[model samples]
Target: MSSTTGSPSPDPLDGPLAAADLDALVDEWGDWAQVADLLDVPRTKVGTLLREHRLAAAVPRPGAGQRVPLAFVQDGEVVKGLPGILTVLHDGGYDDRECIAWLFTDLGLPGRPIDALRENRGSEAKRRAQAMAL
Candidate 1:
């Protein structure tokens, strides 16, 4: 007799991390409109960034809509090395949520992968991202 009142099945597209968990890991987030404002581009062009793997966004939590981690941008542009790292992770079959979670997770790096990228030590983060593919 299976019950129908427990937690719902996880969405396959949500990747391995829960939305709340992903939300907790990020300090700041911005929707595409905000991202456009930051990038000084029309809102429509923001979609191009995601398509190019120059940025990654996720719903964060139910009803939260899509949001990008603010750490991925700095100085009015996508942070240097972030695109390459994101590309690597995406190529490794990690979805947007997984990619964001991985970036914020501390796997014995000097800090989280996002932190390393912010500090301009993206080579270290990129190395880990590459290893994930294998």
Candidate 2:
């Protein structure tokens, strides 16, 4: 495991550790249902993306020329439930519609963040409230 002569490559998700750090993070990834809402994708599509991306385990380093078994927490979340999946995607900045489309045949949701945000935060009642306040 030497550099250019077989040195070990740096792990992308590596850094300072405080004893079982990876294990701890994996333990509290939270529910996929919340993640779906955060990602703005339907619950159904989560499984598809999991299987498609092979995201169940630690994602591999590109062209690292090594088999690094992932340090993933086994929450028994794959195929059956979309749990523990969306957190990774959403945290990685994949928006709702993108997450949905990647898993399903496109729910045809809005692609713009402003529109999406407005849809979530805006409403006729809210508009009226603003008007009245003014």
Candidate 3:
């Protein structure tokens, strides 16, 4: 459900967003169809986009596909810099689940990375991810 070529299984949660809290996280996310509607693309394109790392799912859905966090979508499009930030984190050796956990965890910024993205602070998040690569 991650944006990687092979959807890696989620890592163990070591932050505020623990794996045990996934049920609550799912409530804040949406399915592929909803993501498609937000992006104004076909459902197939949604899958393509996800596979291409244009966006990412918070986690894998119980059955199939993933539920993308609403924070990643803005005005019916993926937020700017999100893909780049994801790439930075991935390049830093963080898997999809780790990325999710980090975003939900506060990095001493004004808020969590996901909250920063939702508030149009993706650049800050990207900067932090870049620093993480050090």
Number of clashes recorded per candidate: 0, 6, 0
lDDT-based ranking, best first? Answer: 1, 3, 2
Which ranges in model 3 have alpha carbons more than 4 Å from their true place? 1-20, 25-27, 58-65
The residue pairs found clashing in candidate 3 are none
Which lDDT tens digits does candidate 2 get at residues 1-134?
64476645332124211211222233223244544444456755545555554333221223422111121112332322222233444455543323322222211243221223224432332232233224
CA lDDT, every model vs. true structure = 0.83, 0.32, 0.70
Per-residue CA lDDT of model 3 for 44-129, tens digit only, reads 98778777677777554467456777677888888777778778877887766556666766666786777788787777788888
Candidate 3 lDDT at 14 equals: 42
**lDDT of each residue in 1-134, candidate 1, tens digit only:** 87699776443335564343777788899999999999999988889999899899998878999999988889999988889988888898878888888888876678888888888888878998899766
Identify the superior model by lDDT, candidate 1 or candidate 2.
1
TM-score-based ranking: 1, 3, 2
User: How much does candidate 3 score in TM-score?
Assistant: 0.73
Q: Look at candidate 2 and give me any clashing residue pairs.
A: 1-6, 1-7, 2-6, 2-7, 3-7, 39-96
List the candidate 1 regions with Cα displacement exceeding 4 Å: 1-20
What is candidate 2's TM-score against the reference? Answer: 0.25
